[model samples]
Each structure stands twice: as C-alpha cells, then as structure tokens.
Target chain A: MRHSTFFWFFLPTGLAMLLFIAFPIVSVISQSVFTPHEAVFVESENCGPFGCTTETTIDQDATAALREAKPLGQFVGLQIYLDRGHLATSEVAAAWRSTDSMGAFFKTINNLPFYRAMGFTLTYTFTVTPLLIILGFAIAVAVNSLHRHLKGLVIFFSLLPMIVTPLIGSLILFWMVDSRGVLGNFLQWMADDPDLSLKASTGLTWIMLIVYGVWHSAPFAFVVFYAGLQTLPQDTLESSRIDGATRWQQIRYVVIPHIMPLVTFVALIQIMDNFRVLEPIIGFNAEAHARSLSWIILNDLNGETQLLSSAATTSVLTILGVSILLSPVLVRTWRDFNSKA
Target chain B: MASQLNKKPLALSLFSTGFIVIWLILAAFPFIWTLWGSFKVELDFFSKADWTNALTGARTTVEYGSPFTGAGYHGAWVQEEFWRSVINTAIVCFFTVTISLTLGTLGGYALSRSGFKYVFWLLIAALIFRAMPPITLVSGYLLQFFNWNVWGILPTTIIVLVAINQPFTLWMLHSFFQKIPKELDESAIVDGCTRFQAFRYVIIPVMWPGVITTGLFSFLLAYNDFAVTTLLLAEENRTMVPAIAAFMGTTQTEGNVMFAVAAVVSATAPLFVLVMFFQRQIVSGLTAGAVKG
Candidate 1:
C-alpha cells in the first residue's frame, strides 16, 4: 500500500524527468551515432556524365531518379556507430575528409581541441574548489567566533558577493583590471611601465579568472560553513576547552571533525558549480582559456559546423566526470543518512 | 562592576575587529571604486595621465584628439541610458520573480506532499538542470525559438529567460518545501480539507519565509544574470548586466564615466534594498537551504 502511494506521488515528476532530461540526453547520444553523411546520394539516374547532376531538377524527376538509383547501402549498424561517434580512428579519419567541406563530424582528434580543454577545465575545478573551501572555512570560523552581537553584521557583509549578479562581479573586476582602470593604474604607477596589461597572456588571464572566482564564490562557501558551525555541539567545544585544549587545537580536533560532513557536501557542491564556471570568465575574457569546461563547450557550439554531437559528447563527459569525482562524497552522504535512519 | 564587565577578552575583540574591517574593505572596495567612477565623466575615467581629472574640471578639453577626444565625466543622474537600463531591469526582474515564485511554490508543494516514488529523481533532474551551464540551454532555446512561429503567444526572449531560471527557482523552492513538516498537511486533510485547500491554507503560510527568500534570490539572479540574457535578449530588451557589458565593451571610444556610474547604481541599488530589508531572513535562508541543510 505504501509503495503504491509513493509511486502515485512520484509518477508526475518521473514522467517529466524522463521526457525533458533523460530524453534529450539519450537523443544526443543516439544522434551522435545514427545520422549518416549526405554522401549517401539519393538519385542514381542523376549520375550524369561527370557524376551527379549539377543542375536543379523538378521534384517528380528527382523522385523518379532516386527510385532508379540502387539503394546505397543497408543500415551498417555498429559501423555507423563507430563512424558517427568517432570511436574508430580509421573510420573517423575517413569521415573527416568527407565531412570537412560540409562541416560535419570531427575529422581528426587534433581538430577537436578536446584534450587541451579538458586539462584546462580540470585545473580550474581542482584549483578553485580547494581555495573556495579553505577561504570559506576561515571566514566562517572568524564570523562564528565573533561576539553574538557582531556575527550578524559579518554575515550580512559576506552575503554581498553571493547576492550580486556574477556579470556585475565580472564587470567590476574588468573595470578594476583594465589597462586604464584602477588596479592597472596602480600597477603602472608601481612598476613605471605603461604597457603591462592583465589580459596579456593565458596564464595571467587564468590568474585573473581565479581571483574573480574566489571573490564571487567565497561568500557562498562562507555562508555554508558558518551554518555548519552553528550546528556544531557547543558542549563538545566547551569540554575540549575544559580539557585544556587551546582554541586552535579545539578547532582542529573537535570542530573540524564535527563539520567534516558539511565540508564534504559543500566541496562537492563547489566542484559542480566551479566546473560550470562561465559568467566571470566569459565577462573578463572572450577566448576560451584553460579555465572552465563550460567555456570550452560554448566555444565548440559556436564553431562552424555547429557540431552539436561533439558538444553533446563533451557535456556527457562533464556530467560523468562530476559524478565520478563526487562519488565518494555521495557515498558518505548516503551512509550518514542511512545510519541516522 | 562596569570595569569588570568591560574586561572582556581583549585579544579576541581586537582580532575580530581587525578581521571584520579587512572583510568589509575587501567587500566594499570594488563597489566604492565603481561608485566613484560612476560620478566622473568619460574622459577622466579613461585618461592615462590624470585619474582625478574629471573631479577637477567639469568638461576638460584635452589636445588628445583622434581617438581620445570628447571624453569626460558627466553627472550620473542626468544619463538617459542609465535610467533605461534601470527600467528594463525592473521589468525583467518583476516578471521573472513573480512567475518563478508562483510556479516554483506550486511545483515544490506538489513534489513534497505528492508522495511520489519518483520525487527523488525529479529533484535530481532539477538539480542537474540547475547545474548545467546556462549557455548550453540558452543556446539551444535560442535556436529553437528563432525558428518558432507560434502565433506570437510568448516573446522569444521572455520564454528563454524563464526557462533558464526555472530550474534554479524549482531547486530552491524544493529545498524550502522539504524543510516544512508534513504533519501540517495530514492534520489539515483530517479536518476534511482537500489537498489543494490544505496546501493553500496550511503549507503556504508556514512556508512564507522560504517563498520570500526564494523570490528575493530569484529576483536578484534574474536581475544580475548576463550570460543567458546577453545571448537571448535583444538589444531593445537588454537587461541591466548586458547593458553594462555593452557599455564596457564600447567604453574605449564613448568613454567610461556614464557606463561606470550606471554599472555602480544598477548593481548596488537592488542589492542594498534587499539586504537591508531581509537581512535576518537572507542570512538564515542562505545558510539553512544552501550551506548546512
């Protein structure tokens, strides 16, 4: 009876998810494999002296000619799969030549720029996640340690970045970092060099991106960690202090352990958010650098062929990478919830 | 007694005060710069030599003609573009918040109490949609709507914006709804109220804080959003962020005073009002729904 009731309750959500999310993903995967090249010519009789007809024909004539043409081939099954998905190197190479002019599937792995993008995205996620976590933890602890009256003020200030639009955040950074802008002017003054620009190179751009990310993201982390701190048992800390543990020692041994679950949870959240870091990086720089996965995906979609299949493949990879990276956190959360139950 | 009371931990107080001051500065510096920059006209902002040239003269004409001519700060209040952006942002935010709150609250309540076995997966789906880069969805929707010819029922830009923001509002409201106790629903049902009636009379009133927080965040998110709005919204319908971006992009020739002032005013105004009004709820909502819970 309970199972039936639960099923009834979940049915609408289940159907909606299947239709919108699951279907689109599956469609992308399937479309990546099934679609054939336009090389499968429809008309045999239109194969004129040189080859296929270069002239336009009536629909009736085209239909008749197509019927006269021998059926190009059968559904080659996994060969189509291999060719379309670009899984087989030789097939990929062959398909590349045919598709290059028409702007179709990737001809060569070198043509895709996937590897460089992946490296950049991984570096961005790994770098930003830890910085956000540590900075957030520090800010949270600092706020938590304040006299009760002052805690509100600190939290209110911290919430500013999170509440402001990321576009504005990036714009503010852009203005500050521009050649004639505030930071740039200060740098020029200090160095006595007028030509030094923040966006001079990929490395400098990545650094700027990281600084912007930390500024924008730290508030979120702080809020989460602060809340986690609030939930920590006061008795544990009081007892640790009574046992002659210093404040730092108490935080390290007791408070930190108590908040580990929350930390892990927030870390996973940060990883997901950071992996899709787009606005600040985009607002700051136009080109895709070794910065974010989403930026690479956007760049690919904007390319000549509009190679949505490749974009879809990259999206799937990102989703998988995030899931895999966060598996341990997920497992731990599950275990904790189950144990409590 | 007063002296004894005043003898609280001096080191802790000093440390905290220093920390607060540093954080306040860090948080306030960019805003302060933006505010100051907004007041100065274009020439003063872009001039290589004198950063304070705008403050010193009303319309200082320098001999740097060709590209750098006709640049100086003007009063921010008199700028027409600034007011246009503010009005456009207000309209966009107004619709985005109102629609998202109504739909999100309804959807959240349905999922929370509907006892559906698939509710977890539904929640996960919403999260995935929220987590996916907005560019992907916005690009897809843009292409889809560009080809659309459905008797002009909904404007293409509005549809795209609403779709992109829906997942976020849904996730937020879901979290809010999950936190509400289920017992209230059961008791209301036991009193012969229908499900919808119970939701209307019992669940919504209690979930007011969640709804308000979700609405405020959604409004801010919509107002500040640049990526989706930039791609999807037309120039005439451009929201504040994109308008500022356009201004920033064109600042080399047009100058920066107007853009800077506009950026500062637009970014800070709504945020200030919201933070001030809902300081307590905002703190609790962010920590509870986002971080801890």
Candidate 2:
C-alpha cells in the first residue's frame, strides 16, 4: 500500500488506540505518582458578641484554588508503591523485626493486602495453566476418536462452560457449592458434617475458584488442540503403527510433538487471561478470602471515595506483572520476525 | 492408526469413553442444574430442609402448583428491571462489534498490505495492548471521564470498550487479511477502483467469514466484560453482567437470589443459541489466532 492510502486506512484505529488505550496508560503512570488534594486549614479569631475565640477553619477558597492549580494532586513518586497496601516496604521490615521466627514473618507478609493478592494471582496462573493444558489435551484426543457425527455435539456442549459469562458461570458454581445449595448439601451429607461450608473457609474458596477457572478455560485449550489434531501428519502415525507402537506411545511421540506449538500458543494466551483473574473473585463473593491484583485495582477504584491514586498504583503494578509474563512471548515474536526478515 | 488396532482393548476404550462422559457431565451439568433450579422455589432448589427437595422440586410444586415456575424470571425481568440492563448490553455489544469491526478492518487491511517493516513494531505494540487487563485502564479513564463530565454513561463506556477492543480486533483481522491474496487488491486497483474502493468491493466480500468470526468475538467481549462496565457505567445504565453483580449488593431480605439465578440463565441462553448457530465460526475464530501466532 502507498503511504497516503495506508495513512488514511489506519488513522482511525491508530487515533482511537492512541487517545484511549495509549494515553490512558500514560495517564495511569502519572496518576500513580499523584494523589487528590486535601482540604486546607488555618487558624482564625472571631470577636463579635462573645469573648475572642480562636478556631481552626478550612480555607475553602484557598483549598479550591489549590485544587484548581493542581487537580491531579501532590507528586509522591514511589510512595504509593512502597506503602503497606502495595510492596509494604516498611511494614515488611517492621514485621521482620517483630517476628522471632521465619514462619511468623512469612505469615505476616502473607497478610498484607497487596502481597496476599499477588500470591493468589501467581498461584492461580501457574496452577491453572498447566492443569488445563493436560486436561484439554486429553479431551481433545478423546473427542478426536469419536464418530464424526458426534464430535460437533460434544464440542457444542463442551463450549458452554467457557462461553457463558464468567461471573454468571462462577455464580452458577458458587450457588451449587453454597451451604444450602445442592452440591453443598450433598457434600455436607457425604462428609457426615452439617456445618461444612465453602464460604467460611479460605482454602475451600480458593479451591472452588481454581476449579472454576480450570472448568471455564479448559474448553478453549481443547478446541485449539482439536484443531491442531487435524493437521497431524498421517504418514508418521502410519509408520509408528507399523512399528508396533501402542496408542500411548503414538500420542507421546507423534501427537504431543504435533501440537507442541499450539500448546505454547494456548499457554501464552492463558497466562495473559489468568493474570487478570477479577470476575471470579467477585462472583464467588470471596473477597474476604481471596483477592487478585486486578481485584485490588477494582477495590480501590470502586467505592464512593474513588481512590484514584491507589488504583493507579495497583494498575501500574498490574501492568508490570503483565509485562513480565509477556516478555517470553515478546522474545519469541521478535526472534520470529527477525528470521522472516 | 487407532482404528487399525484390531480389537480395541477394552481398558483403553472404556477409559476414553469414561473420560468423555465425565467431561461432558462436568461441562454441561452446572448450567443444566442451574437452569432446572432457577425455575424452582428457593427452598426446593437449595433444600436446607431436605436435600431430596432439590431433586424432587417439592416446594416448587406446592408454591407454584407446577413442577416448573417462571417466578424467578418474573422477579428479575419485571420487578428488578433487569430488562434495562439486557437492552443496554444489546446496544453496547451491537455498537462495539460494529464500530470496532469498521476501524479494525481498515487498520488491519492497511497493516497487511503495507510493506513497511515498522508494521511489525505496530503490531507488537498492539499485542502488548491486547495483553493489558481492561481494569488497569479503568483507573485512568475514571479520572479523565470525571474531568470531562462523561463518566458513568453508556456512550462513553461504549467508546472505551471499542478502544480497548481495537488491539485484539486489529491483531485478528490483520492475520485474517494476510491470508487473503494481495493480488485481489492489486487487480481491483488496476481496474480503476480507488484503494478504498478496492477494499470495499474486493477485500470485504472475500473476508466475511473472518469478519463474522472477529465480530462474534467482539460481541462476546463486550457482553462478557465486567470490569469496565461495572466501573464506567452508572447505576441507572448498568449492563447485564454488572447488574447481576449489583443484585448481590442489595439487602439479603429481598429474596432476590432467585433473580440473579434467573438472570444467569437468561444471559446464558443467548450464548447457548449463539454456539448452536455459530459453533463453526467460533471454533475457527478461536484457532485462527493460535496457528498463526
């Protein structure tokens, strides 16, 4: 395409992304360094009817002027990042000094809001990624062997868990696992303990959330692997069969290798998806028990006060996390582009 | 190769069959259970008194004088005004998909056809943007929207979603356009059509499959979104997903748990029908990025 044509064609999207996506990111970075202004105060004396009385009064006009002068707030670079809600630099140091044992120190750090959410987010991402890969691979291989007519029906059903709204699906599972809900009731019966409740325990809530994550995402991996299976080389499979290799060996040697690239692709996307685990946290109403980094940002931004600075700090951290996760894919894409060049 | 294994070993066959059955049940049962339970009274569905009431619909039978009841749907749709959110979601999804598709197609086509090596960097930028969580951007938007006095409105939310959605749309459509022969554009241009004319007359007609696939995904993103919608939309202009979330914030005495249940099923039904109709496009759209990526 010529320069003029390309310019005209790409301008709209480029501008949209620049103004909305790119500029907001810049704004978030800046906002992280600044906070909202506080009301100004001064001492004054009023001696009209009563004895001279000294009092503190908010200088409303000055406060308004100050706000108008610097609406984004005072610059406080890295302070929000190091605060107890985030990196908790001083809090961790104090906790370390207070604790005589490593176990207590570790526990104290785990209780911090930012560290706690980051811990769960990391654990969920790593656990769900590999688990879904294996599960999706198994389902894809099993479905590939079915009668052609039945494949589509199975796929249609398989997609339901993933295609449903994340909150809605998690709620469906949440209620089922609620104490009064069906599965919860059945579990209580099976355990011989009527007091069993997933909501009351942190471990139980985390388990249910992870299970929901796997259930909701595995179909995506399955469909991708299923597509990859069609492109598998028949000649190699025939050769393996002629060599008297068992089905297990065939899949181990032939099938796995055939879909290795697809596995990487799926893993990349899953990491990106899993790193932003917010909806499930809300869906389960497990904010008391579990929170993610995305949840932290939402928590800060959500309420009547609109804690913009705190939310911006979390956003910066969350973006940093995404960048670290994305670095591997970045390297590969760069290498691929170079090779093509 | 497996078919040639003269007698399919009983253990292997049973294992595969069992796995398939278990997976199907695991995937389908939650929705089915919820759908069935949504139609019943709270006691019968949750069954605090007797677990069997859930299976038997005992309370639902006594209350509604039928095995199934539409009370949940009525409460959610009419009493709670969930219909407003549903309509808002429709408007948002329709506009997001259409506008994003328009901008994405033009941009993607340009990227694919252009010979500049910087196109690689442009796409790489888009890839990074695509990986960003929508919530991360919401903080910045909140302040900006407030300053502009446009926060908590449908149009502003819609435009933001379209912007957030643009990167993925461009990535998918770029790859989609790349697969088309560039000769089509060249031929059209040679025949006296302008570049835009060639894109309109030649490329678009050939690109419906990919466009539809991308559009379906855009619609899903707009529909499934919780973060931006919840934050950016006002209380009065909430969409379905966020509205459902808001239902939980109400006082527990309202007996609106059933309303959420009904909304869940109601929201899910359209997706069920969507998959029924567009399973092929969906399957293809999902894998389209993978093989190419």
Candidate 3:
C-alpha cells in the first residue's frame, strides 16, 4: 500500500488512540504534577459589644475564579508523589529509623497507601499467574483426554467464570461467603468457629481476592492451552508411549514443551491484567483490608471529593508499574518481529 | 489417538475425571448458586438459622407463600427502574462495537499491508497503551472531560470505549488480515481499482468471519466493562454493571441485598446467552494471538 492510502486507512484509529490513549496519558502526567487551586481565604473583622475578632474565611468567589482561570491548578512538581498518601519519603525514613525489626519496618511501610496497594497488587499478580497457569494446563489436558463431545460442554461451562463481568463474579462469591451465607456457614461448621468471617482479616481477604483472581483467569489459560493441544504431534506421542513413557512423563517431556509458548503468552497477558486488580476489591468491599493501585486511583476519583491530582499521581505510578511489567513482553515481541522480518 | 496404548490406568482415569468434575463445579457453581438464591428473600438467601433455607426458600415461602419469589427482580427492574440502565447499556454497546470495528478494520488492513518500520512501532505503541490500566486513562479523562463539559453522557463514554477497544481490535484484526492472501487485494488493484476500492469491493466481502470474531470480543469488552462506565457515567446514565454496583451500596444498607442479587443474575443472563451462541468464535479469537506468537 502507498503511504497516502495507508494514511487515510489508519487515520481514524490513529486519531482515536492518539486523542484518547496518548492524550490521556499526557494529561495524567501533567495532572500528577499539578493540583486543584486552594480556597482563597481573607481575614474579616467582627466587632460586637466592645469585642472584636478577626476570622479567616474562604473567599468562594476568588477561589472559584482562581480554579476557573487555571484548571490544571498550581504546579507542585513531585510534591504529591512524595506526600504521605503516595511515596511518603519522610514517613518511610522515620519508620526505617524507629523500627527495631524488619517485620516492624514492613508493618510501618504497609500503612502507607501506595506501598499497601503495591504490596497487594504484586502479591496477587505473582501468586495468581503461576497458580492459574497450572490449573488451566491441568484442565486443558484433562479436557483433551475426554470424549470429543464432552470437550465443548466442559469448555462452555469453564468460560463462564471468565466471561462474566469481574465485579459481578466477585459479588456472587462475596455473597456466598458472607458469614451467614452457604459457604461461610459450611466453613464455620468445618472449622468449628462460628465467628470466622473472611472479611474481618487481612490475610483472608488477600487469600479470597487471589482465589477470585485465579477463578476469573484460569479459563483464559485453559482455552489457549486447549487450542495448543489440538495440533499436538501424534507421532511423537505414539513413540513416547511405545517407549513405555507414563502419561505424566509424556506431558512433562512432549506436551509441556509443545505448549510452552502458549504458557508464556498466557503468563505475560495475565501479569499485565492481574496487576490492575480493581473490580474485585470494590465487589468484596475489601478496601479496608486490601487495595490495588487501580483501586487507589478509583477511590481518589470517586465521590464528593474529586481528588483529581492525587488520582492522577497514583495513575502515573501505576503506569510506571505496568511498563516495568510490560518491558519483557515488549522485548520479546521486538525479537520475534526482527526474526520474522 | 484413543487406542489401547493411550488408555489410562483405572485409578488415574478416575482421578482425572474426578478432577474435571471438581473443576467444572468451581467454574460454574457460583453462577448457579447465585441464580438460585436470587429468588429468595434476604433472610433466606443469607440465612443465619439454617443454610438449607437458601435452597428450599423456607423464609421465602412464609413471606410470599411460594418457594420462589420474583420480588427482588421486581424491586430491581420495576421499582428501581433498572430498565433505563439496560437501555443505556444497549446504546453504548451498539455504538462502541460498530465504530470500533469500522476504524479497526481499516487500520488493521493498512498495517498488515504496509512494509514500513513505522507499522511495527505503531503496534508496539498500541501494546504499551493496551497494557496500561484503563483507570489511569480515566483519571486523565476526568479532568479533560469535566473541563470540556462532556462527562456523564452516553456519547462521551462510547467514544472513550471505542478508543480503548482500538489497540486489541487493531492487533486482532491485523493478524486476521495477514492471513488473507495478499494476492486477493493486489489482483483487484491491478484491474484499474484504487486501494480503497479494492478493499471495499474485494477485501470486505471475505472479511466477515474475522470481523465477526473481532466484533464478538469488542462487544464483550464494552459489555463487561465496569471501570470506564462506572467512572464516566452519571447516576441516571449508568449501565447494568455499574447499576448493579450502585445497587450494592444502597441496598446493602437498606437490608435489600436480595435486590442486588437479582440485579446481578439479571445482568449475567445475557452473557450466558451470548456464550451459548458465540462459544466457538470467542475461543478462536482468544487463541488467535497465541497461535501467531
């Protein structure tokens, strides 16, 4: 295709992405450095019955005018990034000096919003990715062994957990695991503890979210690996069987090696996804116990207080996290493209 | 492939079958259990007295004189006017899918046909954009949209979704376009046709299978979206997912959690139907990238 034709063809999508995706990223970074204007205050004198006092009252008109004049607000550079809500540089230093043990130091750091969210997001991403891969691969192999007709049925049911909206999926589980709900009741019976609520403990909340994450994503892995299984080389499998290789041995040697690329593909995509981990927090109402980076951004953007600057800062930090996770995938894609070319 | 040599030992076969059954239940039981529980009253649905009440709807029978009740659904769809949100969702999904596919097909085809290094960079840029959590983008949009006085409206959300949908759509369709023999379009170009005309006359005719698959995914993204819709929309303009989320906040405090349950089930019903019809396309679309890699 000629450059002119290509330009016309790509213009719409390119423009959409440039405006919405690229522009927003620039906007977020700029917003991170700038904050909403502070309320302009003026001192007023009140004199009544031989008593006089001066009061500092917010001048609404001036404040509104200032905000209206410069919507991006005053530029604070990296001030917001280092504040108590985010990086908390001074707070971390204080904790580092005061704590006598590593556990205490971590406990202090975990109280900071940014570190807390990062802790959960990274833990969730790392734990869920490997676990879901194993579960998905196991399901794929098991389904592959089933009768051909049963495969479709199994797949249809398997896709439900993933296909449903994340919030809705988590809400369903949350309701089931509420203290009085079926699963919660069963748990109390099994453990002989009537007061064992999953929501009350930080460790349990993390476990619940991770479990939900694995349930939500394993099907994606299963589908891809299942597709990989379809084109497996029968001759190699037959030879392995003739050599008296057990089922586990064949999978370890032939099947796993065949699907290794798919596994990598699933892992990279899941890592990018699991890093966000927003909806389940909202659904479970587990914000008090666990928060992800995306959730922090959402919380800042939500409700009576817009907190745009704070949210924008978290967003910039989250974008940094995403890029760090995405670098490996980008490098691999580059290598693949170069080889193909 | 299922011959004597491939036959599993009895214990192994039983274990695998058992595992499959356990996995299936894990995958599908929550929806089943939610659907069943949604018809009961809050007391029965979350019964402290007896867990079996949820299954049997014991308290539901005493209150409504029936084992099952539609009160939760009625409260959600009728009293709460969830139908408005449903209509909003329909409009959003319709426009998002149509516009996304139109722009995506053109861009994807161009990228596939071009030999320039810039095409590679564009795709890499798109992958980076795709990886960024959309909430980050929403924070960027909040300030701008509020400034432009365009927030909390259907068109604004639709355009944003279409934009967010572009990266994945372009990647998927680009790969799909690559599989279409280049000669198909080139032959048309040789016959006194402009590039656009070749695409319009020849390429469009044979692109439906790929387009449909891409369209299914685009629909799914728009439909299942919670992040963009919840943040971008006003209360009155909410979609089903956000509406159900809203229900949780209000109803949980009111002791009307059953309403949220019914709303969740109602929201999930269409997805169930969609999967029933489009399972094949969804699977193929999902594996398309992995296959290429």
Candidate 4:
C-alpha cells in the first residue's frame, strides 16, 4: 500500500504497457507523418559516334543504405494523411464540387478507399451493437425461463460462437453461404434463382458481415445480461405481479430497469469490439465487396511493398475514430468517479 | 426466480422455446457442420451436383472408398507442415499467459490496494489502450521491430501479445483483487510480514481462481490472435491461425481448400475443449468489469 511497494508491484505491467502500447502509439503517429525514402538515381552519359544519350538507373544500394539509416522513413508531416490512400482531402473536395446531389456525392465518396471503409465500419458498429443487444437479451430471457437442467447445455452451446476464433467462425459461415454450399444452395432453391451469390453484391456482403458480427458478439451480451438476471429482485417482481401486471409489464417495469446498467456495460464493450471488425472481412473474403478500417490497414501492411507509411496513416485515423467513440464513455466514467468520491 | 406464478402462457413458452432452439442451432450448427465437412473432399463438401453429397460423402466414397476421410487433416498437418505452426502457437500462448498473469497480478494487486487518484488514471489509460485495434499497433511494431531486427519471430510476438493482454488482464484482476477483503493482507502485515511477504504468503494462495480466469482469457487472446502473429512472425515461425490463413492464400487454387478447412477445425479444437471445462470462469471473467461498473 505504501508508495515504494506500490511502485515495485506495478512496475512490470506498467513498463510492459508503456513500451508496447504507449510507445507503439507514439511510433505509429511518427510513422504516419513519414514516408519511405525514394530510390536514389544515377545518371550517366553514353558517348556514341554521332549521338550522346543520358541513361539513369536506380542506385539500389544507396536507397537501401538510406533506409537502413532511417528505418522510420522520411518525415512528411501530414502529407500521407491527406494523400489519396487515406483522408484524401483533395479528392473529397473535387467530388463535392463535381457532384450535384448529396446521394451522388456520397456515391462518389464511397468509391474512395478510406471513406468507404469508414462508412462500413461505422454502420457495422452501430447496427451490430444494438441488434446483438436485443438478440442477446431475448436469449437471456428465454434461457432464464428454461428448466435449470437445460441452462448449462444451452449456455455451453451459446458460448461456442463467441469463444471460437473470429476468422474461423466467419470462415465457417462463409463456406455455408458459398454458391455451392448448403445455405447458398438452399437460398437459390428458395428464391428460384440458381445464379444468386452473396459475395457478388455489396448489399448482400454487408448484410452477411453484419449478421456474422451479431452472431459472434451476441453471446457475450447474453452472458453478461444473464449474470445480471441472476441477482434480479424477486420482491420487486412479486410486487409487480401482485399488482396484476402481465409478464411483459413485469419485465418492462421491473426487469429492464434492474438490468439497465448491464445493458450500458454491454453496449460500451461491444462498441469497442465491433469497431475493430477485421477478421470476419478476411475470413469471408469480403474485401472485394466490403472493407473495414482495420482490414484496410491489414491490406496496406501486407504484400510485397509493406506500405508502412500508408498503413500507419490509416492506423492513426482509426485510433482517432476509436477515441471519438470512446470519449463519451470516458466522460461518463469520470463523472461517476467524481460523484462517488 | 422461477416460481409457480412465474409460469408463462403456453404460446409464450412455445415461442420462447422455439426461439432458443433456433438460436442454439444458429450458434452450434456451423461448428458441427464444419467438423463434419472437414473430413470430406472438396467436391463433396462444396458439391454443386448434389447437396446431399456433403452429408453422404458420395465423392469421398468414390475416391477414398469411405464415407469419411482424413486426407485434409493429413495434407494440412503433414504436407503443409502445419504442426510447426501449432507448436509455435503453443509456445506463444504458454509464455503470453504466464508472463501476462505474472505481471498483471502484481500490478492489479497494487492498484487495488493503493488509495490514489493515479490508480484511476492508470486504469483509464489501459482502457484506451484496450480499445485501440491491435492492427494499428502492428504497424508501429512492424516499424520498430524491423528497426531492431526483432520482427518475424515467436518471442517478439509473444512479448507483444503479453503487453496487449496486460490492459484487460489488469482491469479484470484489479476488480478481482478489490473483492478480496483488504483485511486479509493488512492482518498479514500486522503480524510482522513485509508487503512482499504478505502478498507472497497470503494473497497468492487465494488469488488462483481469479488468476486462472484471467489466464484463460490471456491464453484465448494469444491463441485466437491472427493480425499480430501473421504480421510479426516469419513464415517458419507462424502460429496456427496465421498458418491457416496462409493455407487459404496458397492452397485455394490447388484443390487444397479442404486442407484449410481441416486446419481451421484443428485450430478450434483446443478452444472448444477450453470452453467446455472453463465455461463458468470465462463467464465470470467477462462480467467482472461490467459488475464493477
């Protein structure tokens, strides 16, 4: 409890977080403002019988040496952030000027990589959070009413979707909805369209990803709400029932109010989780039809070039988005702490 | 809370039961279907000729002379050298969990016991860190690790995972430690034990349940991770998730998609067993933060 003891006890974890979490954030910010060095070129004059020509060749060795000297690349301030790959300020401005209507403007903006990803990420985050909450609450209520013996079985099965790796879960669903797979085949049969493919259309892909998101996260909500349900005030419930309240009325007046805090808790956590939304895109191979900020960063970081600067810029923008989403929660927590103290 | 008066109407009961059944099927059917499909050849698993071939393994019978086959598993585990990745994953998970819990317990204990405003700020900082996508941090790690020549290795990935695991681990364990009556440790100190001695003797023994729960989560984070491991590790040092991802990339065109399927099933088996045994701890761990809120 003393200062020195607390210091020693906290040092290891604090140091880990500082070095990895805090330091990397700083590194990402710096990297975002920097671009990789350009290849050095050497020009040579070739003498011929009647003509002379200048031939320029890349000096790979010098470029490699420069890269070696400064692995963080050349600092370009906020150039990368405004470039076509990321914020694309100029492109947005041009699109705004060119498009006559808001819908057309949005359509043009959607063609830009960053704004397109932002649109999907925000939509997925907002839609999935509330939907999963409703679905989770429904499951919690339904499972709560089941026989005690069935609770464990239902819960064990329920946790499977959430507990499995996100990539694998999405992959399983992806295969099932493949054109030749069971669900896809069944859909074709039901709709009487043998050529229908979920992956071919943007709307369907977005829906698929959203459904996957809800399915994957709903169990987490269910568990938390289920726990909140355990400590429900029987006295209040009985009193409400004695007042000739129906089941729905008892729930509306007694149950939902009691679990309101838990609902907020789940919402906050799910918003954070859903905002990332990376693996499912990869697993579903939905990148062609849909993309998220995390997925774009992943795509940028990958492949032959590594695109470090581009990825870092996207990373910074994504972090800003997360902070914007998190600010309200932080303010609420601070207020609660102040009131309690 | 289930009492005589709490009985639902027949229609309501039926509807709720039906809803639960639909949800359970939605939740469990994918894993079950995948597990069954992983044993068949690509054609039968994704049959266009007849959907029933997936269930009956008609093509599998025609080719391998059996309704089921382990060809995909063998192809993935042996031909593609997926076992190495599995071993790498095991090593990463082991170290990440052990080191994360070790650091987390100490820090969480300190934070819980110390009556200071700074403790609140530290947790808030951690909450922010926890919200930042791991992919963002990957770019940072890639730049620094490349500079340090520490990229593309299991140890580096393990340390990064342990660090990422710390925030949630600290938050969970801090809440857990708060629940342990402060008197337990204060009493130990009164008996002439040093703070370290009190922690080592009194707090450590009673901390296992919470620690175990936190460790389970740490293990899950390290195990299920794809972005960090894929980016931070070299081809030879890949973990199972990344390895399976690699399989998807290279094997999709070679009539080897089933190999990726098998690898996915293999990678998920451990988590399946983990949830089976630690369902309660996992649930409690998840709610620990919310309960405090």
Top candidate on DockQ is 3
DockQ of 2: 0.85
Candidate 3 regions off by >4 Å? A44-69
In order of appearance, the predictions have TM-scores of 0.78, 0.98, 0.97, 0.97
lDDT per residue as tens, model 3, A173-285: 99999999899999989999999999999999999999999999999999999999999999999999989898889999999999999999999999999999999999999
For residues A1-341, write the lDDT of model 1, one tens digit per residue.
Answer: 14454454334444444444455556544434432233323433566578776544356654555544632222234443243333355655676666755445533443445544555667778888888888888888778767788777777777777777776777777777778776878778888888988788778788888877777888878887787887788777777767777667888998889888777767767787777777777678645445455665666565566555555555666666667776675566457655865
For residue A324, what is the lDDT in candidate 4? 97
User: Model 3 scores what on Cα lDDT?
Assistant: 0.94
lDDT of 1 by residue, B27-136 (tens): 77777666555555555655567666634433343434322222222322245355666777787778777766766676676666655445655665576666656554
lDDT of 2 by residue, A155-272 (tens): 9999999999999999899989999988898899999999999899999888889999999999999999999999999889888888988878999999999899999999999999
Computed on alpha carbons, the lDDT of every model, listed in order, comes to 0.64, 0.92, 0.94, 0.93
CA lDDT of B4 in candidate 3? Answer: 83
Better of 1 and 2 by TM-score: 2
Query: In candidate 1, how many Å is residue B158 off?
Result: 4.3
Fnat per candidate, as a fraction, reads: 0.31, 0.89, 0.91, 0.84
Clashing residue pairs in all predictions, respectively, total: 14, 0, 0, 0
Query: What DockQ would you assign to candidate 4?
Result: 0.81
Give one digit per residue, the lDDT tens place, for model 4 in A279-298: 99989999998899999988
Fraction of native contacts in model 2?
0.89
Give the poorly placed runs of model 1, Cα more than 4 Å off: A1-112, A147-150, A191-193, A286-291, A300-313, A329-341, B1-16, B50-88, B114-116, B139-143, B150-171, B248-264, B290-293
